[model samples]
Target chain A: MSIQISDPMLPELYKVTKIQENTHDTFTLEMVPKNKTKIFSFLPGQFNMIYLFGVGEVPISISGDPSSTDFLVHTIRAVGTVTDAMSKIKEGQTVGIRGPFGSHWPIEKAMGKDVLLIAGGIGLAPLRPVVYYILAHRSKYRKVVLLYGTRSPDDIIYEEEYQNWQENFDITVETTVDNTDSEWQGHVGIVSALISKKDFSPTNMVAIICGPEIMMHFSVQELVRREVTWNDIYISMERNMKCAIGFCGHCQYGAKFICKDGPVFCYSSIQETLKRREI
Target chain B: MKMLKTILENHPSFQELEREHLKFVIDNAENIEFKAEELLFKEGEKADKLYIIQSGKIAIELFTPSRGSITIQTLGLNEIVGWSLTPPYQRSFDARCVEDSQAISIDGKALRIRCEEDSKFGYELLKNFTYTVVQRLQRTRIQLLDIYKIRT
Candidate 1:
């Protein structure tokens, strides 16, 4: 594999090409490299270091399709100082783009196998690319199911795309909201609740799970109970990713640097690491 | 009407019982039908029996003086509702028909008397109800999380 790791200390300039507001506090930004040489590629589960001119940087997942090389897409929720500023940045503005770092979901190994994508809240953004990839190569995978849970109907993102995906692809999309109004006439429960309701061959299924740490923990348990092996289950871990490269120690888990080693990992690889009480 | 054999083999609450024990309950069961907007039983009324939905929808509702009646859950085929036949023997929610529905109602008093006679069979029903209770509990807890609240 010819791997070209980018320089970590400095970030390249990327101009915001398009902007779309998702929710009251979340927005999606499409950026393209200002310098032709900085037009880098990334896998489904990798992340980018987004930097505002004066403020610091934060890691946001690449939420666009791999096959579509026009622009890099990221769905960001304004949570802290850096993200809050990035969310406010207008279209056509230039921002710093760094390495599309970390490992990705086993989309390759999942060929001819059933795929289950379980996400909670903002966790759905990172997994969006996987859905795009499977849809792009529909016949390569056997079945794809997306089980997503949010706080309520209003909190759901990509509502239009979900409708399109279900109608167009051979994919099953199930969603649950924690709270619902009378207007919301759908499943009201945790995302994990939908696991047993769906039909999939557990032995032949590869599950990619993301969300809050607690949600991921519970989802892994549910998948295991349904006979999905830990080896076939992958999860994306979120941490304080300061340097897109491994040098900054902020994103260390056990002996691995999340920036360099993974944002995606097989459950078996991190089982013991998650079990540790605290560091 | 759906057959007793189907209920014995597939009802969410009673399907796990041994055939002999399940047969005894099936003997006491009666199939009931309701039209949309009709009541199965009102909240606070005597909990006469437990129901295993055979078809259609039954809404478990709570009637508040202010909000009137609000549906808590709408249960359908093969799902069980009304476990009030257990200890309290008092209906907890007003179960009403949302869509024309059919269910197998097992007489609570007779079922309780039967349980007293057969402790092993009673234990099986207890286990089944526990599962339903836990499922409801977990769903409620998820709602309590109010997961969609935009964090600042």
Candidate 2:
């Protein structure tokens, strides 16, 4: 056996068991830890760097819940070189993984308040872990709503789980597509259109959202219109990340490092950063 | 066809085309109508054709989990839409009609075939598409640069 250096922050190579396509360029990779007994834990928004030997590695948000250490999962979009390499790997192929890193969703604080979760396109992957965490501990919160939007109905991710969330009485879910097809029968418009129609008390609710930078900024404005405090809204961000440890400046968002300060952060905490497109 | 000639003749991108060439292409164009909130094309839909806005607006948007649908850009009259004619013939983003609109469109595949048959038309269309993509790319780069997002 070849001896490998051990890093507390890095999870050992795990074999990818499956890859599920979400959109034309996005996919979900399911991998079980090489040492399954060594539990890897993370907050809902935390991410990892899955190292594919020879082809290199890329930072990917963990889409799996912290509650279960059985298998680590990632929902990734093939945007560049490393991601393209990641998409090519198949079942039985071993890939290196590091970290359940970054600030997690504020689950403890969201308790007892109505939670509004909004996701756009592949942005749902990062929010998936938090949704599972909320549902797993259902009694801790009041009403819940998951409002999502994608390019089209076909671009919606997590089909089975989306249905399951819809079935639960405590949680409500709605989806919108930017463009509709012949078979599509749902609402067709910008995701922001749905906000005006939602009947939720912004005063007693915390909103969690992830997707593109522009989308989050606009969503914040909408929630503010509803009287939701900036502090009550949290948004996850995506940036080019080489080191999950934050030593590298690749994932910098203004003064905050997305890898260190958060992959998830309350709008109040990073309002300034969020405003700047550079972050 | 006459309406198309007038519209294409006025468009900023097509203004440089020789009048004869403009009229020739315009003669083959067709007008299409879209109802308010109707999808023009989805994210992954095959881009079999390209469109030129005659009247009204089209919104290009991207979905995010934290944010619902984020409107990226709104193209109004005289704008060209769709950019999948090259090697990677896939739609990159979603396009929808923000209002009931009228547009002139040409079958992209058919145009490509025509371009193959007639090199001059191919050169003209490619030049126009390149100009359109470059202009849009500049705007997108500025948006992604996050300069406006910064409060200070």
Candidate that scores best on TM-score? 1
> What DockQ does predicted model 1 obtain?
0.39
Clashing pairs in 1: A151-B148
Candidate 2 regions exceeding 4 Å error are A1-11, A277-279, B1-152
- lDDT digits (tens) for residues A1-279 of candidate 1: 124655766788899989999877789999888887655677889888888889988889999998876589999999899888887898899998876788888989999999999999999999999999998989999988999998777778888898878889978897777655454555556788678667899999899998987788888888888899999999999888888578879999998888878889889998899999894
**Residue A200's lDDT in candidate 1:** 91
**Model 2 global lDDT (CA atoms, 0 to 1):** 0.75
Computed on alpha carbons, the lDDT of every model, listed in order, comes to 0.82, 0.75
lDDT of 2 by residue, A161-214 (tens): 777777874688877665543344455544544564577888888899887777
Report the lDDT of model 2 for residue B138.
54
Question: Compared to the true structure, candidate 2 yields what TM-score?
Answer: 0.63
